[model samples]
Target: MKAFSHERAPDGKNEWLTPPEIVQALGPFDLDPCAPINRPWPTAARHFTAEDNGLIKPWEGRVWLNPPYGQETIKWMRRMREHRNGIALIFARTETRTFHECVWGVADAILWIRGRLTFFNVDGTRPKSTGGAPSVLIAYGRENAGRLHLCGLQGRITPA
Candidate 1:
């Protein structure tokens, strides 16, 4: 299967890295609470990997979260909502309960990426195929919402 497919990783891991260009466009973020441990590039000034259990850590500054997919995503989204000062990259599963609970009316804005993203590997290599699903950038604060509005990415931004 293609590495970018979120269904299941060929490497038997779910720790896909976010494309650096996307991060660069929306940064500079102070923290990446769900960063991969062996990333080839820095997503933020500070990072918390799986071992760090970022959900319980003290989150400060503007966060850049590409949280773990699947069931655990809700927890990260909840945390982001509470932090109320950051951005989150997740699959555009608009009908999911997580979206209703943590995003939607709760977030400051939403940017629907024009096309599916091809995520990077932990080693920073590009994938051969694009992701199985579309993605969205959720802005939690006014500054982040403004960043989404003018990030220059090909996407439609909706303010809440």
Candidate 2:
């Protein structure tokens, strides 16, 4: 079960981290837009699947997430909050107060993707599409999002 672990080393070839992946690796995506998954509609590791929905349920342990890039982001963020154990990778849109409250306000950490990502479709197939927007990885509670070290990626929001 090879999930989309964002820990690719820089060994050249297809191992180079794209901007969206980079942002996910970063944390507290506070300065960019969310990147859409690359490809058309259903790639193996890009888009959401029935398997994902099943796995990300209201479990009382660590979790994974790659939410869809739409108005429903807030819904997904809320779901993560309910779980208490979550690591959600989603697009970063500063304008969304709902997103900010659920993800940025409550989340423990945030990663800003440096580039775009082409999300996959539902059938685990790559879509013929690309997104130029940046993205973010929002971690719910205090835990690792994808088994990656949070080091400098740790972030917090202080009231002004």
Candidate 3:
């Protein structure tokens, strides 16, 4: 079976990048645990690409996570929850088991993006269309939650 139905990569690639605007809005992050190996821009002060096995590395300071989108996403979510000092960008699939397990009552706050996000390519190029589904920013700590609230992004933040 395919990892995720929304994965529309025809080339069997999974390196879709987050838009720079979002990062610039709520950024100056200390670490990006699941960053791409060859990114056009910096997601955080430090990054851990696939080669680093970010899931197994030590996470410090404020984190920004745009984890691999698939079954393995849960593991990354759980780690973020445990780290408790970061913000995660993920699909707004609120009813999924992953959301129930990692978000819901666990997240400090959630920002439901107003419109579909247009993820960029590894080389900083954008696709003509937006992502297949809605997206959300899940804050794991109070500081990050405040950042989300003041980020000025087009979203509705629900504090937990």
Candidate 4:
């Protein structure tokens, strides 16, 4: 199988890192199941990186996922749906198959972020530019759903 890594190279592609503020907005989670080797922000004490085959690993507890942006997103979203706990950061592509199959009705809450996010660079520094697309935060558990409601994120929140 191809390596479905999260960190986009310095190749000027759109492998945007989840902004630190966005991660902080949801508060702390128990595991970042699809993190890079050196994460830009702290999401969880435990992480299952792409090298560890996070897609195949058993995911439990409050999870946080900023999954790889392409087809790999389907797999991570599926797992998040199965785990049914924690928050996931993904593009707000409601028309995509991944969103309909894994997110639409599965998430407990959907937070439509107010604007495009600025991702961190591969070296873990703040990027000078904002992301190419709008983002959404999805909560799978009631705790996260409540957190999404009161987390003070600049977005519109709707119950799923």
C-alpha TM-scores of all predictions: 0.94, 0.52, 0.94, 0.88
Query: In model 3, which regions exceed 4 Å deviation?
Result: 1-5, 9-12
Total backbone clashes of model 1? 0
Model 4 Cα lDDT, one tens digit per residue, 52-153: 988898887899888887867898898989899989898787888988888878889999999877777655777666666688899998989999998998
Lowest-sum lDDT 10-residue window in model 3: 3-12
Error of 3 at 138 (Å): 0.4
lDDT of 4 at 71: 68
Is 2 or 4 the stronger prediction by TM-score?
4
**Candidate 1 clash pair list:** none
lDDT of all the models against the reference? 0.88, 0.46, 0.88, 0.79
Model 3, 58-134: lDDT tens per residue? 99999999988878889999999899998999999888888999999999999999998888888778877777789
The residue-level lDDT of candidate 3 at 142 comes to: 93
Question: lDDT score, residue 138, model 3?
Answer: 96
